[model samples]
Target: MPRYSDADLLEEIRRVADVADTDSAPSLQNFRDHSDIADTTVLRRFDSWNAAVVKAGFEPNDPQQRIPTEDLIAELQRLREAVGHAPTIDEMIEQGNHWPSTYKRRFGSWAEALDAAFDDINGEAVFESRAETEPDDPGTPGPHVSGETLLEDLRALADELGEPPRFKEMVEHGDHRARTHTKRYGSWAEALEAAGLDPDARSGGTQQVSTDQLLADLRRLRDELGRVPTATDVVEEGTHGIATYQRRFGSWSDAVEEAFEESDA
Candidate 1:
């Protein structure tokens, strides 16, 4: 028998090893069945199947296993170079078609598939904004207007008006600007604050939720529910199930307390 050379047998073994998944290993029996190499020649090189697999460039249990796709591409590219030929776009397309299936099997969705394919071709995926994102919602307006312009405008308006015009006089005379400010702010105190006045400094008093009142409310809720109220319950009841609760009371304690309050009530 014209026995196959060691180099040819090794190359064939490497090709099979390349296609096998991380969980699989190549065997001498498979080689005998698939290739024209004789068992006698294969036995001469490898003492065992494990030895043959190791020779074909793989550890028995490598955690960081690489996919054979790139290696296969590299081999094909090398062959093309040897024959003075360049792979065409159609050939690349045919090859690229395998990427989605390969990616989906590894990752579980189309988005993940695209991400993996992106990594293979370009080392990283480009960011894709969701279709629902609104283009016109620029954050917080212009810094010039947002931070300083409003204050500047208020200061300018105050300077132009001068000496804090009497709101009672304006209301009696039905001054349009005074009427507009009163309508928007509800009172002179609110209007003064909007124009950047320190009402507390002038009045010298403090306003706060009394601890006794808070305790009374909590006790009432707990008694009604036969349990303590949660933050979520308080927020939901207080805010009428508005999403504002999530913003204010972000802890489990708050939700529990609110829940208890509602239950007790």
Candidate 2:
């Protein structure tokens, strides 16, 4: 990743927002199209794209303003034509007019949204359907795999790999694509939880189910990870989600700092 300073990032945000020609800041996808700097790099400098936009002197778009479902599907179709394949979540975020979360709220998940847009008049899915390459092997977004089966397979894979299996690891060894779990459980991390596998073996063999003071718990997690624990880590391992932290402490970075300071105190 390019090591642009904070000023470079803010300037890029302004450039993207100006190209968007709107009063509100451009979405992350829009920023990506207009600049060489990555969205992740910008986000790491600030806790969020919205925070970066605010620092750049533009108002971020209202996240709650729902796009019409039809418009979202149309954008998906356009991206499909551009990429010449089924659009993945990354592709959607990078190229589509709207974000993946918008589609998730509309159709329950990104895969389901593809079905909505590409399903034939006869109810056969066109975009995400797997052709039966073999009697037993249906392709990706393959035949519906049950949640229990997904979790069980995750366990079996963890036993084989001696660690929590990433989505890519399951490609060659799993009954289906590791990402198939996301269709059932929303994400690979959740799949690991459902299967009871720990990413860091040092984290013990189990997740903490404590409801202690938020700062103390955050401190504990940072100690366990030996670094700042992301919001997803809290959701997967801690007792509360990031939304709860945001409500109590304003922002995730602020909460992390306060938690570390409390430890010093």
Candidate 3:
């Protein structure tokens, strides 16, 4: 093996420090001191100096090659334990920031870094679990369950009913509100509907309605329908009033029946 001059060896140490620093390219002074290449000699083996630097664990010019600053600091501490020496503050900062790309920077992706940094100060590295489906497939957005928003609507419906129904049953019955219902109750539709949504009528289109309109209609049916005639009777009693009700209250039995009669031909 060809032996490097004293200056060449110094340059190698400088390159090592630079890599162990933040992967900034080793300076000309570093090369001058650390390698066999003499300033005055024929420059035949300049390329060899590069290879030597690589062997010394210094990457040349890679932007993303992050030095393991924390690990390096720990090692520096360990060195201090025996050799009574460690890098100064500037050196520590240099080691942590701005790395070269030629070397493998960190172990995992950005998400892994975030998980490790923000979650646990002493956390061990963890690889991400692979997704079961291919990326292009229309799979579930996240872990599957009835959406929480739908469940909240269900809860609101239950409150309108003045008692919780068996929400799970209602959900199982496939009411439009079932998703909302399922979130408040356990993941069961029957349980949610049973929470007291009267899924039989609500789910069946016996009372065709959106959630808020349904609540209002339920209240009207309980309170005002008895005072008036059937909803149909009330509708026929006033065209403008029925239109107004349809506009404000959504669908109703009377309006539905009248429309069906008009279209029956």
Candidate 4:
């Protein structure tokens, strides 16, 4: 390779740090796996690999500090619940305690990590067990709705709930079953998009979210906490992401005030 500079080496370390899935700090081996530049080059300029890592602003990696497989899965499930969908790498970073890299390290890959989580979540056979209990087509007898009608219902539900509809929300509150949506659009996220709604990506700043929804979720958090909730409470345990509230209401304080003001009213 052409002669690399110290800046190049350190930057590569930071680059790997940003994208590497592990929550633990990047190690020299991680650098090797990702970089075209040599580790020896990193070592030649710096006293030690970690010395360079510090310069790049990464904490030293601790191989011993491993998160339990079960904990990782549990956090993934929590993330899914919080966001109302499968957890993504970015979601994991934002809400999950463990890093995606930690899952990759523990489960051999992020895909496998998600599979293990999905299996564990669905009790080892999400489809098989649900199939045993529920009918193949849960698109059961309801007022027949065309795709256009479904979109109308979805938009209507968003207006009613003050947020975009989730799969469960649609099943419970809208005129159609969740199955009908997936049948029409192949996924709930797509269904929301087809309805001209965002998939809570306030997660999809895109979080199902509106002032009323945020207030309800905050009230739920308050009941759980049994005290006034802080922003940390909302982020750590509330139904909606804290950022969603901020985006919707201009501040976490404003969101909480709205929730409580409604209760007092």
Candidate 5:
């Protein structure tokens, strides 16, 4: 096996951390599985797996042992009280007893942590409280989701459904709604267009490339892999990323369907 520098090993650990769920902490197994470097190599380089994980800016392996979950929750409550409202991640990072990641590890997500803290204080659900407190929904819009984030979510949902999403599909299958998209981009079609999709091409074919070219590429990949290419497969092997396909044709499934249609044609 090739020897990796300490910086490379640290970067690999950070990558694992990035992909890990907010409620869970990254483990040695995660690092070993995701990275090209072996666990033994990591141990040898850093003197221990935990040491290597620590160097990557993540909390220690037994974070709950070091800082009790109750204490973490208590600190979250304290921070909320200090701010007189739900504290943002940056505020928690700056003012709380521990890093925001600690809260995430303890509660799956920062929003969940806030909900728990709010519940603890007021004995009411966060959603119910929000509804009661902010009667005017239009005046108090939800958190600002960036265009890039919205696009990323759209592509992820497309990958999951195997096709580009319709307005109703987005409301049903996606985290955000048509109204959210409309608020951000004026219309659902505009959001799709902004995400690199041609809203006019409702047949799941894009004007960017000829159907023949797309079919040829799909057939070529299928021949190479000896199976139908998944979105991940297409991204790694094809000219365009999965998002590109979703944006162009509405979804990866749609793209595949279009390829078949072209083949028949």
Candidate 6:
């Protein structure tokens, strides 16, 4: 194998850190496995794997940094401005300055952190906004929609689209905002499950299929169709569905190629 440059190693570390679970601190083994860079190389390059991770924009693996609540709120606002909308948990985890789990821990949940951020941005308390926007009757559904109602809306939207909408699609076209569902049900996938749909099929929450299972499904589709399976075909016919394959392998074409390679082997 060729020797990796320092810049190349750092870039790979950042790539791995970007997708790793935010709930846990990243390790040398994580960098090694995800980047194909040996742990010895990382340690030799930066004196420690944590040093390399720090250069990659991840929080240091020392005593967990206690981000001030005000700073967390500001980071949320910054993300909202950058994205032109309220940031989702996944968005925050992927793009925000702080970890999504940190925000959740500081505010008791991601929804509450968002509420605080929104309130700070609008210069009012959450209840004040509720008072201004909500109807007189507590029973009436308004901006602060209940979890059950949000689930119903999700089902209705799915029915309209013939499949569950991704988070961006739901934000652009659905009746309720994505933030509303997250606030009510903890995450969109949770809301989706509450609505009696496959959560993995809709939101890219957790991987519902292993790599072996996804490859098997892809091969099965190929055998049945006698050709490569498109994303639509996976959505309509595959066992774990299109979202599962997409999450596992990045895209339909990638999944098809992987399946073919496995079959050839």
- Candidate with top lDDT is 2
Clashing pairs in 2: none
- Which lDDT values do the candidates have, in the order given? 0.39, 0.64, 0.36, 0.62, 0.60, 0.61
Each model's Cα RMSD: 28.2, 12.5, 29.0, 14.8, 15.8, 12.9
CA shift at 22, candidate 2, in angstroms?
18
Best candidate (score: TM-score):
2
- What TM-score fits each model? 0.20, 0.39, 0.17, 0.28, 0.28, 0.37
lDDT of 2 by residue, 119-237 (tens): 64222344334333322352333334456777787889788877776565676678765545643443455456667765334223445423246787788788898988876567446
Regions of candidate 3 where Cα sits further than 4 Å from its true position: 1-247, 250-265
* Ten residues in sequence with the least summed lDDT for candidate 2: 121-130
Over 1-265, each residue of candidate 1 has an lDDT whose tens digit, in order, gives 2123456567767766565423466654355445433333454456544566677675543212334555434543543354333322212222222222233344564344334433333212221232123222222111112323333433454455453333433334321333233223323333445567432222222343333434454555567666675532332122111112222355334644565555468
Order of models, best TM-score first: 2, 6, 4, 5, 1, 3
- The number of clashing residue pairs in model 5 is 6
Which digits, one per residue and each the tens of the lDDT, describe model 6 over residues 1-265? 2134678668767767666755544765465446433344466567665677788777777523545677888988898898676665545543556656566567777667777778544323443454455433322234334557677778888888777765655677766666555434434544566677775553354545468877886788789999987654554355564445545787556878889987988
- Distance from true location, Cα of 10 in model 4, Å: 19
TM-score for candidate 3: 0.17
Residues 1-265 of candidate 4 have per-residue lDDT tens digits of 2234578668778888777776756875577566544454566578566578778877765533545667777998898788675565544543456645567668786667778877545332432343344332333322233568778888998888777765657667777565556434534554667788766643334534666777877788778878878754543345454445656887667877888988879
Q: What TM-score does candidate 1 get on C-alpha atoms?
A: 0.20
Candidate 5: list runs displaced more than 4 Å.
1-60, 120-265
Those runs of model 4 whose alpha carbons end farther than 4 Å from true positions after fitting are 1-60, 63-164, 170-196, 199-244
Could you tell me the lDDT of residue 206 within candidate 6? 50
Superior by lDDT: candidate 2 or candidate 3: 2
State the displacement of the C-alpha of residue 69, model 2, in Å, after optimal TM-score superposition.
6.2
Task: After the best TM-score superposition of candidate 2, give how far the Cα of residue 232 lies from its true spot, in angstroms.
Answer: 6.2
